[model samples]
Target: MKYDMTLTEKQNLTAYLISIATITIGGSVYNFAISYFLLNETGSALYFSINLAISSITFLIITPFSGVLTDFLNRRNIIIYGEFILMLSILLLFIVTYFYGLSLFSIYIVTFIRSLFNAIVNNAFSASVSNMFHIDNLQKVLGLSSSIQSSATFLGPILGGLLFGISSFELVLFIFLLLSLISFLFDYSINFELFKKENISNNFITDSKINYFKKFLDEIKSGFKYLVSVPILSTVIFVGVFINFFNAGDMVLPEKMMINVLDFSPIQVGIVNGIMACGTVVAGIYLANTKKIENHLNVMRWGFIICAFITILIPIPIYLEKHFQFNFLYLSTILFVKFFVLALINVPFIRIIHEETEDYMKGRVFSGLGVISSAIIPIAFILYGFIYDLGFYFLPNIISAVIIILLSIIYFNPKKFI
Candidate 1:
């Protein structure tokens, strides 16, 4: 795992990776158990959807401001305090679950609080990345981090199902609490300021003697101003919002078709999901082994194109439904390639943002991008869900692919986008 890093650098990297991994794994397990737990308790999918919405809606509301806070505040403190709060929250949940069992209201409240802090911590961590490691190793670190996260996400649900099957809900919470503590300790050991550059302006302060709230507002305005000023950066972000909306088809249609259209079993659906996640992990590992990417926009555009082409092929197996094994294999193969290409799009897009934006502006820009990108996902999901319900099972992918291909061509002007 050692590249050209020094001992201290390596230690910091390890601590950061471990911290993120533990947090993700714990969260994944908690999420899986909580969803089914809520449904079983209430016998309603509405509660589960509400729980999911709480997280997403909280992120939408908090993320933009979190970005400003990330740039203004001591990032290290933000992360540490955020993790500490998460640990305390989980501890509280553990106690509540053990004494009184779980209530829907209590669960909702905890989810909101967790989402709020997660938004802040995620923004701070993302904005801190460029300052966390050497430029030469930036892509490598990002790739490795992506793989770590993808792996945690892949494993968390499987582990959650296993644990939740045999153990008490309180035990699951207790285990998550322990992992949270481990993550907090690892985060504490990281030196977030070690690689920070000098003379970067602190947007939270001003010689105009303004109040803190006024300064914060001014900083946010400046951040947006800077974001629009960079043609390439903002353009790519806009493209991301556009692409991500259409990308929801990939999320919605596959499982829906496998079950509703072809009548796949639980085991078959689970295997398909495992294949999708494995694609992401494999792509991340591939990127990590490479040194750098040239022409990030080009790579991302091609990735999108390839994914769109694959998306059109996803419904082909429906015609061959008589052959169960063939249908499964075809769907699995295409979905794997789709996710692999999707993963390819992410690292370069991030690298582009890192390279193009000013160091001081990263938090706001990233946060702004986050807000823009995330807001569209739920909307996309709703639209795709509606289309699917309308008996347009195959239209979603085909239409989405056509739109992507057209957008790619329309925005293919190098001078404007690159």
Candidate 2:
């Protein structure tokens, strides 16, 4: 019943990072393997797209409540239990696949449930970051977390592809199950309550059923109110929505161009994607080693602007493929720069939000931010998918670049921050 507050700040941060790294690695590999499995099983791009949309839809529907849960419930238990449930779900899937069979409906259901828990766990972890470590170490932790994530992204597809090619789908699921167990152990080691706020602790224990329901609604409303009350925060949310809509190309265009247009082998495509993720890794390292940024907003603003310019070059390889042999080097260089700039934009923005928001409000504020910023993404993905189907591979990048440039011009000014 006692809290584990024995670990020092450095130890806590290390445990937290290792925990995140393990989960991300497993999740990434599972994602890659599942995508391929679904495509091979269904042989329908439409079904694949629908499967993709499930996560976003789940985020929109469940994320609002998840924010409240993180704030009101025990954060450490939320993370630990959420992760446990995720692992259990996947284990169940593995057992079913091994004994009876795996159904598409089951896949969709598990994906939805896992997505819901992921939102809760992610909100808790993000909201707890400021409480877990000193404010001075916040950037370092964020930076290192980003590095872990980007490294996972880089490794997942390659490893997943190798495993899938050599092993069965059930085996991949079991591997992920094992990885999740490892992550759980690391997560259990963290003393999330070490810096816990007294009044915030055990919030749900004191509330009656009816009072808790009403209080949850009020908390959500207050979170939204606080988000809009801050001019820069609201502006950042708007900009996030705009950029994310266009940035959907980051997920779609790369595959469409590399695999569909340029006739890249699976290995070639993986290499290019890995190279882009490496750019993010480098940027994360740079941020982790640096001192506090005085004008994070300015840094973010220019980062977006630079990324927009880099995005415009994404389709050049496609255009030149008709005349000469398609060299991935050119496209890789462009993506490396683009991803690097994106990391710069993202890390500072997250740090700003964490630094500005009060501890009690961080969960809801971040959840509200997640909802608004992501609301446009599914639509954007559909639009880009439709456009790519029409053989307009270059159109998405051009459209994204122009819109991001215009939005940055209008919204991302130094004066706005002042």
Candidate 3:
């Protein structure tokens, strides 16, 4: 695949990239700030995970309709509106924080609204990526995109930690608001042509039919059939779903260990996550320059194996600290490698989705994948929270390792699925 692009395509892509990076940074900081605040104040992973679960479950449900929205509406407008709503919501939350301290219920309410907007913006932006770049350069562009995003993902927590450590959480929220507004401006720069294959005349009326419940359901069904039509793509989506579900243990358990077992402060946790992002940045730049890996499945398969090993070993640092008096940042070390491998493994998967699906179908494919991937995060989050409350912190890691290893050995054999 040739990597060359027209000047206009280049500009649009650049604008889109900057826009997404800004918003992602804001979102990441918000997540870290809140997690640290809740964990510190309540000292309960259960409450924090419950809030997270509610948001995730709502996000899962909204995603299907969101896909229909992305396909039916102007994709750019959908992105723009989504950001504005999120920024507004954060502003309101900031106001609430200043006037009255946030209760658990207030947090859940805000999380619910944020999830709706996030489902729209995230799904639309990802779908747009498929449309914006050339196929030859798609993987490399995706890698570069991941690298840009890694800065937001990894550094957000550190920024959040520092902001929270030195100042108030509201300050972080204010910064998030500013970022969102700027992100929307960047997003507005690109133009879209989603009607490449469809009729242009009277298109507005035809697309409006999607507003009806029946038409909406029909559209959602079409997206599903499209995904199932491709065996490898279908398998990939299923694998992603299972990975997300089982990996919930890793998400919660590690933070729990870091907080209680490793005795790391939020700033330290942020630093570890930031370091992990740095690794991803390096991996991403390499992928951006290198040609695509011919066998992306194998790359992802090995990723599972590497993460499985790390999952099993996650609890060891705490053991060492308690028994052997080792003082290394164990969680940070494992996460660094984990995110680096993730950049390799995930960027390719995204490229495949873009390569496999058509533009009109991009909405359903991305949204469907999102729905399934998020289907059980609530359950996983809440269940893991209970596991932590019961002092089975390391047990979840053991379970996750076994699940991942078994999946890698059995499920990853292409002969079975492909």
Clashes (N, CA, C under 3 Å) per candidate: 0, 0, 0
Best by lDDT: 1
Instruction: Give the per-residue lDDT of model 1 (tens digit) for 37-127.
Output: 9888799999998998899999998988898888777898999999899889888988988899888988998999999999999899988
Off by over 4 Å in 2: 1-7, 197-214, 321-326, 388-402
What does the lDDT come to for candidate 2? 0.80
List TM-score per model, in order. 0.95, 0.89, 0.82
Model 3, which residues run further than 4 Å from truth? 32-54, 90-110, 161-174, 194-211, 265-267, 318-330, 383-402, 413-418
After superposition, which runs of candidate 1 have C-alpha atoms over 4 Å from their true positions? 1-3, 203-214, 412-418
Q: Which residue pairs in candidate 2 have backbone atoms (N, alpha carbon, C) closer than 3 angstroms, thus clashing? A: none
Q: What lDDT is reached at residue 48 by model 1?
A: 90
Candidate 3 local lDDT, 1-418, one digit each (tens): 4557778677877887787688788888899888887799999999998987788788878899888788767787888888888888989999998789767777788899998888988888788775666666677777777788887786676678788889987898899999988888877777665223452232423665455777768889999998999877887778766876777776777677767777777767766667767878888899989876877677878888898777777767666655322433566677778778877888768877877787777887899988776666767888888887787756777888788777777766656655
User: Clash number for model 2?
Assistant: 0
Residue pairs with clashing backbones, model 1: none
The Cα error of candidate 1 at residue 268, in Å, is 1.3
